[model samples]
Structures are given as C-alpha cells and as structure tokens.
Target: MNAGLNDLQAMHLRRLLEGGLPLDARPYRRLAEQVGASEAQVLEQIQRWQDEGLFRRVGLVLKHRALGFRANAMLVLDIPDAQVDEVGRRLGQAAGVNLCYQRPRRLPQWPYNLFCMVHGREREQVCQLIAALLAANGLDEVPHQLLFSTRAFKQCGGRYAPPPAKEVANG
Candidate 1:
C-alpha cells in the first residue's frame, strides 16, 4: 500500500503526467517551480512513489501507427480452454506478436479465447506471420480470424480533469 499523498502532491502528480514533462535540460527543477517544491524534494517524492509501486514507470510512449506501422491486425485464436494460457504465453513471446491476451470464449457461435496483435510493413507480411504462428503452434485445425484496423479516431493520454462540465461550472 502506498502512503497517502496530500491533495496538493496528488494534483501536481496528475498535472505532471497530463501536461507532460518539461522540455528543459533540468526538468525536475522546472517541475519543482511549477508545483512549488524544491527539485530535490520532487525527486525524492517521485523516487519514493516508484519504490513503493504507486507508479510503475514514467517514460515516453511512441505512437506506433504514426511510425509507419500502417498494417496492423488483431489475430484471435480458438484454443481449448485448458490450453489457452500456454498458447497465449507462446504467442506473446513470438516476434511481431505485439499484444496477446485472453478473453472469454463465446460458446456455440464464437470460440476464440486467445488474442494477439501483429503490426508489419505490409498486410501480406502480417498474414504470413499469422500463418506461421498457427503452424508453429500446431493450431492449423483451430478456428481463427484476423481483424485489421481500418481507422483510428483518437489516441491520447488519460483524462486529467474532472470532466469539462463539472470543472468549468465549478470554476
């Protein structure tokens, strides 16, 4: 359990993530000024939070789609319930399989339980990789489907404000 942060520190933490880190040589110093703390104090609090697992990581998340990953697909697998975990683990370790997860298998009509993502230079290449995975996993007999991404409407960080209506009206 993390030690409870006072309201001010909590607000500062949210602002830091939502607005992003300062683009300066010494971001800690800049952030300290913005949040009304010494750089050393800010560093100490952040380090403590990290040590306590309150925050997992603080780093850049590159936009893969914007970086020429034009072809992307979500591959769903219909593995036996008993084998889903093993199959998911194997698929997750495979190169090009960026995301692998397990979802409930809808019976009768739907059977896919394992899902994985593949992003590549071309749709053909992504399909080939999926075929290879099915073969390597001895899942040629299993049912599956590949759902390719058609469009991306919005992609951004988490919500920081308490909802525009509430915040604006209260302010």
Candidate 2:
C-alpha cells in the first residue's frame, strides 16, 4: 500500500495474484495490461510491497503426481538438538531432497526434530535415494523413518488478500 499504488490498482493486482500469475511467457506484461500500468511499474510496486514485509516470498507449488512422480516420502530424523542445525543444512543442500526443515520434538510419542521430503517414480527408488542421502551426510546410524504418502493432497501457495466486497442492491 505505497503512495505509488492507488487503492483500485492494488485491489486488482491482489485479486489477480490470488489465482496465481498468468501462464504466459510475459506474465508481467499481462499483469501490467490488466492494471493499466507499465510492466516496470507493476514489478517495482511488487518489490516495494515485499520490502515493506507484505509478503516474504513467492514460490512455486509443483504438481508432482502430474509430473509422474508417484512416490513421495517424508524422511523424519531424530537428530540431537546440538547437531540438528548442521544436519538440516547438509541435507537441505543434498540432491533428491525436495524440502528440508526442523520442528520441535513432541516427546513421549514423536521424537523427530528434523524432516526432509524425497520424491521418485517408485517407492523403492525413493528409499534408495533416502539411503544414499543419509549415507552421504554421515547419518547412517541416525534414528529415522520414511513415511511414504498414501494419498495425494491439494497443494497451493498462500493467499493473503480478502475477496472483493459484494455490491448492495439499489433501493
């Protein structure tokens, strides 16, 4: 909401973003056309918003199943608190690791503090890849589990802007 952007333009841009960027070679140009502004202006406004902390990032949500990646697994590890950060960084950079993150260990039942995702065309392939990742990271003896996804779930990016207000009927 900078001075450079009017309320109407901001609303229009947010509504368009809610559905995701247009699938075109020049998506920015398309967005500029919709907002009646130059592509550079639109990009500059987006950068300003980002700098003001309106949104931290914009990223892709891949449809792995559609790409023929049938096997997906969450590899959870029970790394010691002291070494969790180091281990997580190493695994995050390794191949075959789609995503990596750390979470609090829910003791007495769940003890995993680190998690990474691996995907492949088959369960066996995923398992082998996970094994290689662990071995390469020198975590051969770490306590872990490979929880393969049993079903595909909908995936999408974050939506921040609210829907447009409904127009009232005239008396």
Candidate 3:
C-alpha cells in the first residue's frame, strides 16, 4: 500500500515475500518471475521499501525446540533503576543470552525490571551460562527468577494487510 504501488502488484509482492524467497542461486530472479517483475526491479523495490522505513531488518525466525534446544528460560532481574541501563548492556552483550531488555517494575508486587532469555539443549547448560553471565556482569547477588518454557507452540510470521478498498457504484 505504499504510494505509487498498484493494488495487484502490492498483493503479489506481499504474497511472494511473506513465504520467503525460494532457495535458488538467483532468488531475486525467481521472485521476479513469480511477481511478474524484473529481477533488478524486485531488488530495487525492496531496497526502496527499506529506505522508506516500511521495512525493518530482514531476519530469520528459528524454532528452538525443533533444533534440539529443549530447554528455554526467561530470566528476570530486579535491577536498580540507576544501574539498569549498564546492567542491561552487559546482559545483552553476554554470549549465552539470546535476548536482553529492560522493563518497568510493577510496584506492590512484581519488583523485577530487567529480562533476558537463554536457550540450550539442557537446563544445566543454560544454568551454567547464566551463572557465568551473572558472575561476569557482577550481578551474582541481584534478585532474579527463571521462568522455564513448559509447552510447545506454533510459530509463524505476522500477517499484514492494507485497508479494504472503498466500494463505488458504476453508473
């Protein structure tokens, strides 16, 4: 729905891109064929979309359980407000942590603020990594809790759509 892109072309582009590029030497060429566009045009359009801020970084989403990473835990730390940023940076940079972030504490109950996720084939391995990370980051004494994954869930990319076209009577 970006300006200047036709409805049909936009739908085709979305349909093709959502499923991901085909595994081929010339994926752009294949995409172009599927979308009825030149390979260079396809690439150029994508770059244009990115430049226009309509796109974030293109990345892969992996299924940890399928990859044998059966153990996963989300660690929440009660970091002081003054030190949260520095601690978060250290946690984010640590090797074992897949994701690190800071969030506000829910007062009167939940005191934890910072969070990070660690995944491994074994819970012990994850625990070891977390221990090393904590000792290295000087957060060994920080109040923290670990929430483990208890069930499997389906995974898929989000779907997006433009507003529906307005209906008009043809006289």
Residue-pair clashes per prediction, in order, are 0, 0, 0
lDDT for each residue of candidate 2 in 25-75, tens digit (9 for 90 to 100): 999889989988778878888887899998766877889999999899999
> Who is ahead in lDDT, 1 or 3?
3
From the highest lDDT down, the ranking of the candidates is 2, 3, 1
Comparing 1 and 2 on TM-score, the stronger one:
2
Which tens-of-lDDT digit does each residue in 48-67 have in candidate 3? 78999977767666788899
As a whole number from 0 to 100, the lDDT of residue 21 in candidate 2 is 92
For every model shown, what is its TM-score relative to the native structure?
A: 0.75, 0.83, 0.76
lDDT of each: 0.80, 0.88, 0.82
Candidate 1, residue 86: lDDT: 89
lDDT assessment of candidate 3:
0.82
Q: Per-residue lDDT for 1-171 in model 1, tens only?
A: 334445686577566756667789998888877777677777777787679886655666557788988788999888888888888999999988987999997788888889998898789999999999899989888989999998877665665544223344554
lDDT, candidate 1, at 98: 82
* Model 1 stretches astray by more than 4 angstroms: 1-5, 18-24, 55-59, 157-171
Any residue pairs clashing in model 1, and if so which? none
Backbone clashes in candidate 1 total 0
